[model samples]
Target chain A: MTTSRRQHTLEVLVENEPGVLARVAGLFSRRAFNIETLNVGPTEDSSISKMVIGVAVEGHSLEQVIAQLDKLVSVISIKDVTGKVKEVHDTQPDYQN
Target chain B: MAHIPTANGTAMTGATSLVKSLEAADVEVMFGLPGGAILPAYDPIFDSSIRHILVRHEQGAGHAATGYAQVTGRAGVCIATSGPGATNLVTPLMDAAMDSVPLIAITGQVPSAAIGTDAFQEADIRGITMPFTKHNYLVTDPDQIPGVIAEAFHIATTGRPGPVLVDVAKDALQKMTTFNWPTSIKLAGYNPKTTPDAQAITDAAALIAQSSKPVFYVGGGVIKANAHKELRQLVELLGAPVVTTLMARGAFPDSHPLHMGMPGMHGTVAAVTALQKADLLITLGARFDDRVTGKLSTFAPNAKILHADIDPAEIGKNRHADVAVVADVKETISALIPALKAALAKNQPDLSAWLRQMNSLKSTYPLGFDQPEDGSLSPQHVIQRIGQISGTDTIFTAGVGQHQMWASQFISYEHPRTWLNSGGAGTMGYGVPAAMGAKVGAPDATVWAIDGDGCFQMTNQELVTCALNNIPIKVAIINNESLGMVRQWQTLFYEGRYSNTNLESKRVPNFPMLAESMGCVGLSCERPEDLDKTIEKAMSINDQPVVVDFRVHRDAMVWPMVAAGTSNDEIMIARATAPDWDSQEL
Candidate 1:
């Protein structure tokens, strides 16, 4: 199976804490996955923060990464903005079906 | 997900899930020193698979992590407590930042309430690290923990990769929060294009084809980007000679015909001559650091430079590039390779004249030093002999300042990550522990930590770690009885004011006693005559880490010294070009 590479923009809700950034990227780097862009900032509530991670993942790797991310302790939400790309070659038509 | 490891699950105590989250990130190692504010981090550290190697000093933690990253090709992680602890990590972070190493430094901060209140050991860590780090965050709440860590690691090892700082406040670690790792990030400002621009590649190729005397001045950027294969292809395509900066040691195979060795301060005479004669200079992944440029105007004077790097800030930071292509080194080289192939029409031109001049310089000077035969210790002779015995596979790590420069100039590091040092950060006490870490990474390989007296003393306490772990590392101490580089400056510029730079009192300190206290063996090299046997014995002892203290000349200085703030070209060779020592072999 060919690994489909796509850049996805994710806006995540997180609990801002010490060493969280290191914990987070240490996640991806440890997996040896590639993150293309990443920026983080606080939201209205000081307790909550927003993280945007632009990572390149193969179709196979995306499912594994997302499943692992869903299991994090501080993550509130994860939204994929990769649809921002023009209807590129159908990535994982199996997911839609 | 109650799989979250928590102590008591109380509202006052934050979850160890953050550490668990780090495990998901695959952080197998953490080099840090513990302190009061960071207790929560330690609580979970023991539970996670992530091994925490306690460095003797906080500064050493950063160096250890940097050394780890340098050899393993991974983002190095370091942690420290609030205030002084955090401050200790700054030099190493700056080194990682300067050299574009993928480094993440996490420090504990006084709780938000204690901040700005002159609380015990409280300092504005984020503020101090702002300029040095590629990005930094003062994590405020438990919810923000996972995302911030993800971003920190991402920012550090990406694009023009550098160090990233994450200062965690005390309260945040005490709060309870659910963890969710980030699967992706959306950083608009950080767009790193891996593919080179077609037009610029074509333009660069055109510049190369027309120039009669072309040279490749490669640097560390190429190594960081893992572009060795592409760089070699580009060099071969251009059929021109290549000269690298100290930081760009392994960008090209040192054995290649076109490779002219390193240039700049203490640079090879051949490489320096080649840089002076080249008409077209193709620089890759290197900043024109002053040490590498000597007199800037006179440097590559005849050559028009084509500078390429991922960081745009470095495009014209030191010397103005005739043409600056701001792109990743690998991308730029890949593009250039194709362009050159497409535009290839001529075979290799005759570089016989240039080669002859370089060959003559190599044979005449040949970077040799001899101590009074059968008299005492010579660091040069020790290092040279070590190089001969260790062969190329045995990796070498050096502490800053003069010893590092000397190692870079003299050692032929054939392996890509074989030579590790505090290049940009120039941390003195980095060698011992970094060598310790290198040995840990590759257990079977012989690891040598080459250090100066100034550097060894800084983190020499780590000698105990080697003893405890029984990590057999051979250390060659080039003890000069002073902060030799600073003293060198004092001798040349400061009119020998002789302020606090001297370490004469400790010149003959009982290093073996110090090592014995830590359960490690130490050997002293007092006679320049007994240098070879001392080195051989040090390298042979596999029982514990060994220290070979070579009592080098106290007044010794690294030649080709460039005065600060001067152009890279304005260098002082041999302290005013007068023959201080005869060129003849003693």
Candidate 2:
């Protein structure tokens, strides 16, 4: 049976400090996983930053990548925005790129 | 407190505090070499309770630390200076990361003022070791030394253990400050989930109770979590077989009736076939490595995988798990056993027929090798002899290649941490230094290193370190006169054209002589009859290291081999006749 790869958007909250992004990116690179797009921005809490990363992963690898992202000391929390964002965009008729 | 210089609250140098921090971590020994940039850190070492081993190469120090960690189930510490000294440690750090060994590597960087400048002996070691380490820090202030050191140990030892690097500036070590050890840590994002989800455990238990052809695919995490007892209990409760991976060699005792030997590449035929035919796979603490799941698509095609691991990343990385439990391995396994027992009490699955099938496969294709009737020594015979003589408690360390695979197959491990090899990285030259480290960590255990001619030549310099430290570890080099594994592959796949794989005695450095020059008692056994006596003589000597070189047949290959990218079902058993050799005389 073939398992199709699906696009996943993960929003990770992390400590705003030097090398934190490198730490997260390093893990993905080492595991040989690909990142489709990534964006980092300041969150409500100035001490913590938000990183949104999008990637195509099979069902199993998605769970693994989420688990690995949780292990980083700088990562505060993670939320899967893949299905939620798609739903919100589908409801809004004027929603554009 | 009495040793402090201050009248009211004593102040101390960062170097002194660093040593105190290591003491707080309950470190009894450290493996390292002294250097200029790390000179300040060395000053306090003279007064500390920790014993520092002087290694010939920094790589030796690194692997030695990894060995210590593997044996003691604690974080092993190693030290080095900036530039080349720190760079030499990269390989072991990478190896430890891949294998998830707990290690703490401390390096002395250039002075803070000289860090950015092109100063002598300057290197951005933090940057160099970043990708490989689980966590790392560069201490600029002496006040941060105690806290950083504390966190380094905490990070190194906890949750899916791996190496942690701490680079201290030379000035930071020399600067004097009030010593206030941080009693508490507040790393907001660093907590590990140790308790698995209750529903997931239940789901797994139900799956275990429902399936007849169930197999426990155990990995290194089981050993790391010290959950062997729980694993054994679960296996008994479910009445299923277990196939321990290379990393999980001793997690399940090989002598057990239901134990299928190691699975995947180089694994026994029964173990490989059992995994392929299994309906339920309870994978504990192991990532689905490419080695274990050859041609991943065809691996365990009929099985619904239940992966229980501390690292969530491992669960679905290679194969999709129907039930995923992320928690401490001991906790997860302990929870699983009771649930499975309870589930089985209601309606037990009849696994007797499945067990019979597995046993039949086991008996039909048992791990075997033929003894050369021509009086030529076989490496397998030599290793099996060592295993028989040393008994079950002897810890075996091996370098990569044919000798490593032979050592794994021949040596039967009954306890955890008895087999130490570079499994994931497949590193050559890991045997000697790792054996030295294992001997140092477990002083009372009989530590033996089984190495190949090609692998032994990689890090034999550590024999001097072993001799100097009075670590009496025995090393048996299965000298086949060439890179046996690669040659075997060349013979099978490359049309028998051996290129640069040969390490014949006439061309290469003499192993026995090299061992002798390094202050070891070097013994060679070319005749099969002399193997037992030579090993006994080597084992009797306790004052220094002993090296026994067993020159076996150059072409003897590791049997029951699973060619890379092939299904485990098609494992190649021993060939009836030897293949053709090139110009080299047999």
Candidate 3:
């Protein structure tokens, strides 16, 4: 049975460096994951950057997405804040044509 | 804190420090080829305790390293020069990644200044290997060498083992710096969960108890986690029929009554049927690979899966798990045993009918092929005879083909790490070098490379390396004189228009002569009666490598095959009543 797609916002902390964002985006695209929206910037700690990524996934895919994201060496941590973040922040993901 | 070249307590080349760090990691053996870029790294080998095996080709180094890692459960190290050297290592690295083998590939890059200027023998080693590696590093700074090596080893060996590459620039090896080996890494992004959630375990146990037709589907993760003992316990406790994947051949003892052999595209009818009919699939460390799950939509339609794997990506990749337990397979099995026992004590599900059904399938459609009355040798028979003659502790590696499937079907692996093959990648030319590497890792174990004739031609030059190094691994080339697997496909699906599958020539290179020329014993078995003696002679010579070419039937095909994208339920067993496509008018 197909589970309804739920929109989830995840805040990912990663090392600030070249190709870090590309690595993150590459993983999502390779796995064929539907990214709703993504925003990136430097955190309070300049050495680390924070990426707020919004994606619509099934209940089963939520764990997989988080797990796959966590596998990146550049990614520091990821937290799912679906309800915590306002839905207004979500935008159409760039990769979806 | 052993310093590299502490002459007046200062100055050391980057290569010396690199060797020092590798020693710190207790790397016993390194398989590699040297070139202009990596020449500096070769200088320190004379001073270091590590044994360097110079391979004929760079690809051999990668496969040999993989073989060592598979058996030793440690990161096998291989080195290569830049450009073509690095590119050659690609197949093995990708193969290692696919199989989750722990391996570390070190490639020397062009001088820091010369990089990306189209310098001779310059390649983007790090960028080339980025997709498949667990992690990688391009170290332009000599100071980071020790830490990078440490991290590479740590990452390669831990939590779903895989290949990691460290591409060191030439200047890094030529320049001097003090060595400081980082004892631990603080990678915030790379923590692997080793413990299963308590609730997930409880849920899995409840599902296990409630289901009547349950099957324990095991894979390579059990062996990697050293959970075979726990696996056996779970099997005995539940009394459920167990089906091992191609990678999980030796993970479970096949002699046990409940063992139902392999389950997949070329698996036994009993194993394939059991999974299709199972109500619950307790998957331990095995992914639902497409080969195993033929026509995914119809695969195990009735079964609710409980997946226990350390790698979370594998959990929901193909089939959605009812309970996904992310932990080391050994630990997960250890936790599940007690919970499973508790559930059973509360109420045992009736499995007598299921057991009866399994037995009936096993007896009715047992794995077998037609034996010609003309007394020609069959590849399956050759494998069986080898199993009988060779010691119980023998390790077998096979190149991919009909021979690989035949070896899997015929060989009974009693212990973990005893059966090594390239399952996920289905890589040909893997048997020779991999067996040599396995032999190097475990010198006492009798290692045999069960290769197809076509595959043996790919990397059999490694036999020279084996013979010279005194790595006496037996190689049995199932010489069907054709690419047997593809020929079988062409025969069945492509209207028997065999396209370049036949390798026959007027003067076929004498395998025995070739082996003898390579400084090893060579033998051949043409008749069925001579098979026992030839294998016995091959097994007796333990000092150096031996190659045996067994001429078998060219037209033989693997049975109980689930054609690609076809339903598992529609497994074809007998050849007498062929499929409709074969009999169709062209």
Best by DockQ: 2
Q: Write the per-residue lDDT of candidate 1 for residues B1-586, one digit (tens) a residue.
A: 1233342233323436557556655677888888988878888887778888887787778877887788777788889999999999888888887778788888888888888899999988886775567778887687777777878777777787778888888888888776666667765335565566777787787777767777788888888888889887787766677887777786676767677777876676557667777787788988877667766666777788788877665665566677778788888987888777766665445555655655565556455454545554555656667777777888899888777877876677676778887766666787998888777667788899999888888788887877777678888888878888888888889898988988872545767667667877878877755767777787789889888777776665676555665644444456675222334221
Poorest lDDT segment (10 consecutive residues) of candidate 1 chain B: B1-10
| Model 2: per-residue Cα lDDT at residue B275 | 90
Model 2 Cα lDDT, one tens digit per residue, B184-289: 7778888877998999999989988889899999999999999999889888878898999999999999999999899988898778888988999999999989
RMSD of 3: 4.9
Which 10 residues in a row give candidate 3 chain B its minimum summed lDDT? Answer: B577-586
RMSD of each: 11.7, 5.2, 4.9
DockQ of each: 0.02, 0.53, 0.51
DockQ of 2: 0.53
Q: Rate residue B447 of model 3 by lDDT.
A: 94
Candidate 2 residue pairs that clash: none
Q: What would the DockQ be for model 1?
A: 0.02
- Runs of candidate 2 with Cα error greater than 4 angstroms are A1-9, A43-46, A54-61, A82-97, B1-9, B576-586
The residue-by-residue lDDT of candidate 2 on A1-97, one tens digit each, is 2436688899899999877888888878876777878999998889999998987784346777887778777788999998776677688756564
Give me the candidate number with maximum lDDT: 3
Chain B TM-score, candidates in order: 0.90, 0.96, 0.96
Instruction: Tell me candidate 1's TM-score on chain B.
Output: 0.90
